[model samples]
Target: MKAVILAGGEGCRLRPLTNHCPKPMVPILNKPVMEYSIELLKRHGITDIIMTVHYLSSSIRSHFGDGSKWGVTITYSEDGMPLGTAGSVKLAEQMLTESFLVISGDILTDFDLSAGIQHHEDQLAAATIFTKPLDLPIEYGVLLSADKKMDKMFEKPNWSDLTKHSINTGIYILDPKIFTYLEDFTHYDFSKDVFPAILKHNEKISIFEAEGYWSDIGTLATYREAQFDMLHHKVNLPSKGKEIAKGIWMEDGVTIHDDVTLKGPIYISRNTIIHEGAIVGPQTVLSESAIIHEKSEITHSILWENSYVGKSCSLGGMIGHCQIQDHSALADMNDETVNAWREYTKRDS
Candidate 1:
């Protein structure tokens, strides 16, 4: 029972691509949206991670450093500033000594979380929040609960503080005395200051709800609708590349050129290149060494790593990290390339 992953904000609505990527290394399908919350907390076995990191904390410590390629054992609480969401879990409260799990590395949930930590140790809960049912909880903060404990909390709540629709999927399961309601340098806020100061001291916090599929990449229009809801599989990730036909995902040094006109839910990473008379995708994403030269025409795009789409560029949007050329479309490119891309950054997160 150990996981922290708050990954400190600074996504700033994904501006200029977080001005060099650090909204937990954004890029949904080609991986790294906090690597799907570290493979959903290593599929609930919870490999002892911590990861608090502020702003551009060296690109998330040079890409999950001690996480040992995802078997997980990372630590790094590094926030020298901007600590809000419960003051960044009270700055990892001395490694959260007991039952811990507080997610949000730019969210995208699968959420079983070991049945919400076995219903927070069979309701002997000290802290546990994880809720769902949000048909516009109206910009969040709802949670009411009854037998599962959490009595009331309403912040933007209305419709008479809801008879049903809850919110707060900022996931949690604390209890290391829940850090005694936090106060290290104060900016506490587990829903605007530690669950209303733990229900104003009557204490008793648990509230589970949770089922599956939650999204919060935060802006860039919900990060382009969470990468088209992971190419419409609707989140149960792990499809990096290898489909090769039905939705066309191709990985190994890919390079298609016999008059290319492929389309599908498309993803073509790892040494990508598609030249002759190109007509890419229905929801394209081509990271890892990308380049589509000839008659270009990408649709519903995203092309990050080492991208280069120049020749005949009929490109759509969000074309790659840098160097793009113009053969047409994309608001016709020229006003000094729209003032050097004044932060549209070729569209979306």
Candidate 2:
């Protein structure tokens, strides 16, 4: 079956990182976030795919050209303007002739798409939405289903009005017939417009309660959480590099000097250098060619490609492609300088 990947979101919450790249292209464990979704689709035997792109579309296109590397045939549908979730898929209507699956590119999940497909076919429903129970439902569109049929839907409901914690996971098995509800070149979201209209017209909308790991890394907090989850093996994400030590994964050409302490659950990408007396780890990711100088300490942080942490520096949070000079701590950097560094990193990287 063909699948539609909505990869057009601007990812405003993930500011500095998203400033240089699209949300789908955001790196997690030295790999683009959307790459995991593509891998997941491949695992479920869904190879034919269409990706909808808008903001920084070229980045994604260049990264996964034709999806050949992943053993899948991928076609891209570019939107000249912001065409909301379902609207973006409508642009590629000709390519989706049969029943198709719709998923968000920014989300990471190991959900059983095959099982969800089977559920959709067995019910013969027009659309089947994958839903998961969330402890905090205020940020997501909540759904109330009875006997697998969606009874009511609420978009980002307030705490007082919340009736259920089951929220939309932005994964859908949609029959081509559902295309009749969408219009081309318009801003229309599935949750805000299409799905609610379907319920109003009394059309069949089934809900598949997902079982397995799923995370929508929309904000900085959740993004960090997703990294930690992968490190802890909460989700079965395939490791990219070789496992040099028990919990440390390192790519080829990585240089580590003696006296450098690396705690478990850390990933150092290709050609990265960790100098002597440097301490790094415990949920940290060093992207390709990153440099951690002597006596530097990085904990629970991410260093982007080619970023430099000078000697004796200490960093705890996200560090994009920028240089932190010797004897400096992240806390010591002024807001203006940090902003300038972020801008410079975006431009240079």
Candidate 3:
């Protein structure tokens, strides 16, 4: 079966990182989120895919060209204008000749796609949405279902009903016939427009409750938490237990000096260098070719590829590409000293 991955979102929430790169290209544990989705689809024997592209389309095409690297064939639906979720699918109607699945590129999950498709086929519904239960339905809209079949969708209800049912997980097994309900290249949203229209027409739409690890890493906190989850084996990712040191994992050709101190749960990509007296770690990621200068400290941050951390520096709560000025230092370095230190201080002074 072919699958359509909705990768056209602007990803306004993950700014600066998504400023240059597309949302699907954003790395989760040094691997693109879109790659994980592709791997999952390939596992289910869905080798043909149509990825809807808008922002930084070339980057995505360049990264996953031909899909042969991942044992799949990828065709892109390059949107000239910003098309809504359903509209994007409508734009690729010609490619989706049979029943297919539509999933968000930004979401990360190991939901049973085989079961979802099976459920869709068994029920013979026009569309089958993958749903999961959430503790806090207020944070997300509650999908009302009866006897394992979706009845209505209530968006963010005011009162908390104990019988609060499932929520849409943004994964759907859709029959090609559903495309007839969508308009091309228009601002037609799947949730707001298409689904509601389908409901009005009294068409068969079902929901399948997923049972497995699932997460939507939409915020900074959730993104950081996903890294921790991968470390703890709560989620299955490629880099889960690849740690070389106690909390550090170095790729091939990484060089670290004896004077360099690395804390646990840090990942340094291939060819990264740690200079003398540099302290890296406590949950940090130094991408390829990143240079850690002498006496520098980094904690709870992610430095993009080829960034340079200056000498005598401390970087905390940071992210993405940068070049630190030489001789810069963070204030909380000297625990014994209760006063602030100069930003640029000489070693002899």
* Candidate 1 lDDT by residue in tens digits, 1-349: 8888888888776687787677888887778888888887887789888888878788788877898887979888877888687787787787777878888888888879999899989987778899999777766778878887888878777687688788888888878876787878667778877777777877778899988899888766567667666765677877577775777777888888888898877788888888888899766788888888889888766778887878887765454474668585563344543343343333423
Ranking by lDDT: 2, 3, 1
lDDT of 3 by residue, 82-191 (tens): 88888888999998889999999988888879989999999988888898888766655578888767677766666645376577888998888877777666878777
Model 1 whole-model lDDT (C-alpha atoms): 0.78
Give a tens-digit lDDT track for model 2, residues 263-296: 9778899989999999997667898899999999
For all predicted structures, in order, the TM-scores are 0.35, 0.92, 0.89
Q: lDDT of candidate 2?
A: 0.86
Judge candidate 3 against the unseen true structure and give its global Cα lDDT, from 0 to 1.
Answer: 0.78
Cα lDDT, all candidates: 0.78, 0.86, 0.78
Of the candidates shown, which would achieve the greatest lDDT relative to the real structure?
Answer: 2
